[model samples]
Target: MELIIAAGIIGLALGAIGAVIALRTAKSGTIREADNKVKSAHAEAEQVVSEARRTAETLKKEALLEAKEEIIKNRQAAEADDKQRKIEIHNLENRVMQREESLDRRNDALDKREHQLSSQQGNLDRRSRELEDLYQRQTAELERISDLTREDAHKELLDTVRSEVTHEAAAIIRESEQQVRAESQKTAQEIISLAIQRCASDHTAEITVTSVHIPSDDLKGRIIGREGRNIRTFEQVSGVNLVIDDTPETVVLSSFDPVRRETARVALENLIADGRIHPARIEEMYQKAASLVEQRVQEAGEQAAFDCGIHELHPELVKTLGALRYRTSFGQNVLRHSIEVAELCAIMAEELKVDARLAKRAGLLHDLGKAIDHEIEGPHAVIGADLARRHGERPVIVHAIEAHHGDIEPNTVLDVLVQAADAISASRPGARRESAENYIKRLEKLEKIANGHEGVERTYAMQAGREVHVMVQPDKISDAASTVLAHDIARQIEEEMEYPGQVRVVVIRESRATDIAK
Candidate 1:
């Protein structure tokens, strides 16, 4: 029994130990599974942090790129605006500069005018004092010499007034006649205006230089030639100057004579084409060119006469008319002006029922002397009259040409027509394109010359400086003094002023004596 009991205890201990071992084995397996779960969670957290960092880095890079683009855009916009402002400021400066220059010119003119006025005032005051002293002396002398009283003088003045009543009646009749003459004057104005309106002609201006273009700069040395002999020959033959400058394949020909200039142009063109430049070739080409120019001149003359319907002009007169093509007056073509004057004269003569053909002929040849005035002396009008006379023209026509400028005084209707036509042709708008400064200077000079004379109350330069009228005080100047003043003023104007045609001087004086009966 005891053995059995001990065996039983051992079996129990063995069973308990087996149970403990199984439990310990199951505990170990649980620890291993927990460790595996912890490791998986750590790895997942690391992966999430890495993905967030990558997203942050991409956002930072995008923001930087956007900032750089915005900066570049703003800079471009600011630069464009700045450029625009600068351009505006520069333009404004230019306009302001122009206005300042104009104002300066105006101020200078004002100063000059003020100085002239001050001088005139001083002269007038001194003259007035002298006249007052002279009048006082004259009055005293008369009072001392006369044996008559105031009552006798009054009675004599009444007698003189009674005797002047008949003359006053004639004056009233003259006033009535002037009132009736308005219709005739109106008709005359209509005719003149009609003549001006019907005439239309173009004016051409000529310069003293011509330019020749070459294909290359290599031709410049050839034109000058070796040792400059070719250039000298060209100058002597053509009577023109060869201006070889650094203007790049260009040569300028300068001459006072248009015919010679035209010849040189043609000849130079030929020589440049022929490529043979020498003294001998130059002379030969110049001769041919001159012949060509002569032929062109004749053709031009014939065309001019045909256009004017004037067929019977002398050949010499025709040639002179052609020469006028090269001449300019105040930037107006002389030949064209002559043609316009002729047309105007014919129109006016037709309206006035006069000889239109004779008027046209005289008008066309009126400025003939201008063609050779440089080679002759005396006035153009007088020289032209002599030319017409020598060319077998009618005496009346020659007189018309001379009298057109009033050098000989207009005696016939044709003379008056020529004068009127010439004035209209020259004074029209755009006919004489004189600069504004020159025009102002001419007017100022006219006033200056008139102010120089004594016994002049006031002076006015009228008709675009074509006439100057002087008014003299009656107390300071008598009628005879007025006539002398007119002559003196005219002579002074002739000596001092440079103008075209003629200027008429009119001096007017009026005396008034007023008495109140009351």
Candidate 2:
């Protein structure tokens, strides 16, 4: 019986161990399910956070888009405001213009009415005066025939005659003539003053030579060339005098024709730059220089014509006009003088109510004769007129050309204006040059005159001999005497010498009376 109990205990232990293993496996499966649930909850939380972030980003994007739209809308509104303002401004300007035009029209109408009223009033006054004169004449004729008392009749007749034949008739005639003359003189003064003031250009003398400063004296030998062959060839080709004088590093190119001188100058500068002094180079430069001078001349002529409001000149005329760039008359450049005269004539013609176009044309062509005067024999005016006539200038233009110098009768006011303007330009102060000798002579004459005056001790020519300052003996000459001496000197200068502008005479009386102690 004990052996059977041991076998029962072993069987119970094996069954108990198998039940514990089954229970442990079920608990492990439950823990795995809980872990899976926790993982699912974490995933859901992450998904919610991501959706919130996306919504926030989308909201921010929408806000930004609205902000941009607002900015654009504001900008568009501002642009619209500006556009509306501009339109309003334009409308206001138009209204202002319309108002001004209406005002101008009303003023014109009022002026017209006033002029008509004035004319009618003048006509009525004239008719009333004529009727009174006729009635007085009838009464005078009746009184002369019916004389009652001789003395009374005579007194009555004298009173009637005195009223009829008063000084008022002569006074009226004189007043009318004076008004006409004053009007004419006033108009003339206005025209002349306007012309002068408008064209008041500073005049300068002309020269045919240009001095080119060389880099050094060494450049001179190169220009002279080997045995002076280069210089000879240059002169032959350019027709300019190359004056290599004592002047160091400087050479003078002289020619009567400034164009030729300029051509030579440019060619020389080019040759010096190239440093190749040869006959071939000289020829090449000469040809180029000739072409350039021609071009410059053409440009000068075109510029002059444009500035003077003259257009459409013939090619030959243009070329000839350019030649004037080299020509000068009485210390004033011919080209510049022509332009000034043309402008002055235009101004005068306008003020005088004459043909401005014709005046300018005549003025411009006035000096055309000077271009060929060196080559021609007769007076420049006649020669220029002949040349213009050949070139198919109008008869009026030709006449003006001849008449500007007072050589012929000027039929048109254009001719007179040109003449007057030319005279004004030429006769202006400092327009021409006086020789040094002549200037010195004038100064000496002025000094001698001042010295000849009583109580005058010494004299000096001041202000380029324009003013004479006389130092008089103060002991002999009073202040009043100094003034008298000044006037006398001025009178002497005026009478004895023909000077430019005017000369001012000044008398200075300075005295020194000293007694040295012995």
Model 1 C-alpha lDDT per residue in residues 1-518, reported as the tens digit of each score: 33444455556555555554554566665755655544554565456556555666777789899999999999999999999999999999999999999999999999999999999999999999999999988877776788665577789889788546635654564566478777587887788778878777778766667889999999999999999999999998888999999999899998767777888999999999999999999999999989988887777778878888888778888887788777777888888888889999999999889989888888888988887786798888999999889989999999998998879988889999999899889877678777789878988888788778777888888987888888888887765556666767788888887676578888878877899998
TM-score of candidate 2 versus the correct structure, residues matched by position: 0.51
- Give every collision pair in model 2: none
Q: What is the lDDT of residue 69 in candidate 2?
A: 99
TM-score of each: 0.54, 0.51
- lDDT of model 2 at position 423: 80
CA displacement after TM-score superposition, residue 40 of candidate 2 (Å): 99
Give the local distance difference test score of model 2.
Answer: 0.80
Worst 10 residues of 2 by lDDT: 1-10
User: lDDT value for candidate 1?
Assistant: 0.82
**Residue 140 lDDT in candidate 2:** 75
TM-score of 1: 0.54
Q: After superposition, how far is residue 505 of candidate 1 from its true place, in Å?
A: 12
| True-structure RMSD for candidate 2 | 29.9
lDDT of 2 by residue, 349-371 (tens): 78767888888888888988888
Scanning candidate 1 in windows of ten residues, the lowest lDDT window is 1-10
